[model samples]
Target chain A: DAGITQSPRHKVTETGTPVTLRCHQTENHRYMYWYRQDPGHGLRLIHYSYGVKDTDKGEVSDGYSVSRSKTEDFLLTLESATSSQTSVYFCAISDFGSGGPYEQYFGPGTRLTVT
Target chain B: SQQGEEDPQALSIQEGENATMNCSYKTSINNLQWYRQNSGRGLVHLILIRSNEREKHSGRLRVTLDTSKKSSSLLITASRAADTASYFCATSGEQFYFGTGTSLTVIP
Candidate 1:
């Protein structure tokens, strides 16, 4: 299970409002990722953290930002939620890096609705 | 867009039949991983095949990678109704990119 949890399994917020989704892990993995899944688009990476305080932007990372203050916690924030930003978000953790083929453990996920 | 493309997009087969799905990606990769997602749930890792490895097996799951073609295929043997879900292939390099996914429906 990798002991991963995501806060607010479901959320509904108005457009222009700010929303923050949290991901916590117990394994203290070196890599944490944020991804969004929408119909026809599958999963798109938003942002990822390689370590505490070390993060990088992903393919679809325009409106989102992430922070990893601790090895167990990674946060994703939407400065101003938009209708187009509504989607199911997922968090994943991996113990390895680009050096090898390592599998990732995923959290339950967060479904956000922007109205 | 580094995202890979999954073929067929959807598949259906009777229980006990073998099911296969293919994924194609661009650019080089360090490894390829397959995942399954049940409805309304997070993805579960199924298997991983490194760039140096051609094939790997985990239980009923078999994965093959062809770096020369930048493609990979996943085969599910002796499928069961519980195996019905969305399958995705992700390529890992400097970053990770996921395919659109193939939805498999196993009839009982």
Candidate 2:
């Protein structure tokens, strides 16, 4: 599906450095989300955007921030990357008005490494 | 902080054999979904069973959800080499929570 796409498929950054990962969706869905996956841990939501300029944090949003300036874009940024932030990041989109079910489509995922 | 947890951390079976994975959750949910991920990639949605539904089928995939037990099971019939991947079960509450995932290896 041509719904979602994440930029910088792979990245490496140093601790205390700022990092930003971009997520773009063509479906123009009303909901977008960012998540990180680590070994022994399943995907954990970092943040989500319900509409343009509207966003909310998820479970692991301590060092992360998100911005949604457009309906098709959601950006996840790390104020100061830490070694613990090294993991795979995935972007997903959903239709809150679908009234069908909680079906979310995920992107290819970006691998981030912070040393 | 996933609400659901899957059992049998890993599973391996011969092609054409049946493989089953279990998932348990902590609280009420509107629906349960199964997704498959290949290696370090993103997940692909497989099937979704609502709280009121018991079982659902799609191709060789069969998913059963038991709200009473707050658990779910995924059965893959006629497993194939192409089915080798990690399967995750997720539940929906105020947010969606995904399990740690069950790794399935199918040998040809």
Report RMSD for candidate 2.
1.3
- Reference contacts preserved by each model: 0.80, 0.58
The regions of model 2 sitting more than 4 angstroms off are A97-100
Q: Taking the tens digit of each residue's C-alpha lDDT, what string does model 1 give over A37-101?
A: 99999999999988899999998999999999999999999999999999999999987754763
Query: If chain B of candidate 1 is superposed on the true chain B, what is its TM-score?
Result: 0.98
Candidate 1 is graded, for docking, as medium
* Candidate 2 clashing pairs, residues 3+ apart or interchain: none
Runs of candidate 1 with Cα error greater than 4 angstroms are: none
Cα deviation of B37 in candidate 1 (Å)?
Answer: 0.5
Query: What's the residue-level lDDT of A30 in candidate 2?
Result: 84
Q: What local lDDT does model 1 show for residue B108?
A: 100
User: How many steric clashes does model 1 contain?
Assistant: 0
What is candidate 1's lDDT per residue for B1-108, written digit by digit as tens?
Answer: 889999879999999999999999998988999999999999999888899999999999999999999999999999999999999999987567999999999999
> Among the candidates, what TM-score does chain A have in each?
0.96, 0.94
| Model 1: DockQ vs. true structure | 0.78
